[model samples]
Structure formats: structure tokens, C-alpha cells
Target: MAQLEYADGIWSGIDEAGVARLEIDRPEVLNALDGAASARIIDLCGAWARERGVRVVVISGRGGAFCAGADVAGMATDAAAKGGFDESDSRAIIENGSRLVGAVRALPMPVIAAIDGPAVGIGASLAVAADLLYASARSYFLLTFVRIGLMPDGAATATFAASLGRARANSMALLGEKLCATEAFEVGLINGVIEEPEGLDAVVARAAAKLCASSPEALALTKAALDAATLTQYEAAIDREIAGQTRLLQTPEFQAAIAAFSAGSR
Candidate 1:
């Protein structure tokens, strides 16, 4: 098992037991993903999927967040450099964001997401893509897309509605509210929620060990069957999101919201 050099805030390594770990470390910005980070994740996921020795994959974020969504500062800078975020720029983002989620979903082995803090916007979407999601009691999920005058991307449309139902998904996407980890557990959005502050790592470690001990063939088949049955509109939703978000990225409301976001909050 060779340790990988951290790139774009992402650190990855596969252990001797074939259990792989992917960590996102951008605590200052709450683990927000820039284009480079997104690309690195996508590339790593692809490579792991092809590596026969990799058994189970666990994803987590360092320091206080699973992920905060996209790096607004990066996007703002890129847009300013180009005068505006055109369709080309929009597609570039969609490519990285969408493919990153797709890579996670398509992993051949079991994928576990251990969320300890905030998972907002696309971050929430990405976490839900994991086959098993375990979050800490203090962790919260939010979709801030509407606040930024953009529709949810990263296949959130399907993942949220599928896990949280249409009404709850509407509550998140339209109202842009935060759903605490306990609430997410009650709503059946997450597999489990650790009540203790430091309990998340122990839970994730146990899950990974359990997955590693299980039959790989049966696990893969079960995952495929479940996804086929429930994720009926996942692909279509991704396409729709890309189309909708691209257009929204060029809208005045989105531009104004982004400009204000730089001054006030992310």
C-alpha cells in the first residue's frame, strides 16, 4: 500500500487490507472544492475503481466539515478574470462536479461517507452518493443553491429527492435550510448518526472493517441492484442539472448573488 501525495487538498491511500481512504482537507474554507480539487478527486476515484486490490473506500473531510460545497472564491476569481461565467466556463464546472459525483457512485467496492460537520450544497449531494453515509450528531446538511440563484447540481436533484422525498427535497432546495444530522437520521437520509463528538471515526472504522470482511462479489452485486432499483432518474437528473445550472450561471441573479457572497458569507 503506497501513500499518495496530497494534491489540491485531497489525500488518498490504500492500506494493506485493501481499504482505501480519501480525505479532503481545506479546513480554512470548510473543505470547499475548487476545480483542481474536484479534478483530483475524480482522477483518484477512477484509478481506485480500476485497481483490483482496492476493497472498500471511505471518504471524509478534515477539521469541521465533510465539505462546504464549491469554492466560491475560486469561482468568483475565474469569473472576474473572464468578465463573466459563460456557458463554456459553466460546462467546465459541471464536468468536474458531475464527474466527481459519478466517480464516487460508480466505485466497484463499497463507498462510505463519514461526515463530521457541515455538508452543504454539492457537498451534501456528494455525501449522499456514498453507499453508506455515517454522520456525527453535530453534522448538518444544507443546499444553498437557491440562495446563490442556481439550481442544485452534482446530481442532487435525484439523490436528495430519492433519499429525502419530494417534499423534504423541496424544503432543502427551495427554502435552503439546514437539516441537522439527527433530523437526517429521522428522515432516513443517512444510515447512522454518531451522538458522541469523537464517535464518528470509530463508527467509520468499524464500517470499513465490516465491509472489508464481507464478500466483494456479493457486495458489488447488491449495490448494483439497489442502485438500479432506486436511482432510476439519476443519470437524467444529472443531465438536467447541468443544463439548468449552465443557464443559471449566466443569469443576472446568480451573478449578483455571487458578487455579494464575496463580501458577506460563503
Candidate 2:
């Protein structure tokens, strides 16, 4: 496999069998994404979309954790420096994050998420955005946006509902609970769960290899059809999330929540 490094902690390469692997390489912060990393992900996905030789795409993170979520600390600092969250910052975040999710879903070939740890907030969104999701036994999914007085973005409002039904999705979003790998599999949220990271890697590799053996045209068409059927509300959900989150970000309640959360973490 030939590997290349991209900015904002992204590493990508194509294997001999035409499987492209993308890794979020920031282990220090559990692969939490800031604006630059998010933008890089969008760029990588766009590049893969144009690569005809790539039969499947595998996304994972370099650290033990897949992704903890967005860079809350960074965002808090920026907000504090700027006299709090403004409309411009909120709009940029929503636009950039939506674009990232859209890019992942737009890929013609199958996309797999090899999750080995926490996938929270927008990270959870990215995982569900993939066609297939494989998780390690230690992995968990969380949507804690409500805990910070913000709503979920990255089209999660749609993906979660489409994957796990309304009641379950509501529980996660409203309660801010952690869904472990086993529970995720039982709830039909993931394709498979393995006991170890190596096992998860092997399973994802086998699945990718199997997919590569099939007819690419057929796979692409089938994926498109399934997405059309299931993700009909995806665009609209994103739009709603952006509008709602923008207003929420400017709310006094959300600002206070962010401040308290930040202080508690310290």
C-alpha cells in the first residue's frame, strides 16, 4: 500500500486491491476534530469520490478512541476570546460539518467505519454516515450535545432516526447516554462488533475485500438506491439542524452550559 499524509492529521492510501483507507491521525486528543481536520476529511472524501480505481473506502482513527467529538476546548477558547459564540462562527461550523457528512455519503463506492472506541457527537454522525459500521467491543456511541445545551448536527437527527427508529434515537439524543458496541449491534446500529481492535480490522478488511470482488457498477447503483429510499429526509434534517443549532449557540443557556462543562472538565 502506498501511503500519503494530508494536513490536519489525516493519513490516506490505496492498497494493492484498490481499497482506500483513511485514518484520523490525531491520537493526542482521541482524534477530536477541529475545523481544519473536518475540512481535510471533506477534501479526502471528495478525492476518493473521483478515484475510479478505489473500490471501497475504510475510515478509522489512529488512536484508541475513534473520535471523541468536536474540539470543544478549542471552540470554547475561541468563543471566549470573541466575547461568546456569534452568528458567523455558528454558521461556519454548521456549514462545514454538514459538508463533511455530505461528502461521506456522496461516495459512489461502499464506505465502512471501523470504530474501535468512542464515537461521540459529530463523530457518531460520521460513523453512521458510512454504509457499513464495525466496532470493537470497547467502543461506544454517544450524542451528548444536549448536555452542552446544543443540538446534534452532521445530519445525526436523520441518521439516528433512520437507523434505530424514533424511540431509541430520542432516548440517545435526549438522555445523553452511551450505547456500547454490543447494544449498538443489538439495536441494529452497526454491522458487526469484534472483541479487539485487530479483530475489527481483520473483519473490515475481509468485508472490503469481499465488496471489491463484486460488480462495482452494481454496488454503486444499489447504494444509491438504498440511500435514496432511506435518506430522503437527510438534506432537510441537515438544514433544520443548522438553523436550530445556530440559534441555540447564541442562547444564554447554551453559553452557560458550555462554561460549566468546561470548568468541570478542568
Q: How do the predictions measure up, each by TM-score?
A: 0.96, 0.97
Which segments of model 1 are wrong by more than 4 Å? 1-4
Which tens-of-lDDT digit does each residue in 24-61 have in candidate 2? 98887789899889988888889989999999999998
Q: lDDT value for candidate 2? A: 0.90
Span of 10 residues, lowest total lDDT, candidate 1: 257-266
In order, candidate lDDTs are 0.90, 0.90
Residue-pair clashes, model 1:
0
Any residue pairs clashing in model 2, and if so which? none
- Report the lDDT of model 1 for residue 88: 91
RMSD, every candidate, angstroms: 1.5, 1.2
TM-score of 2: 0.97
Error of 1 at 50 (Å): 0.7
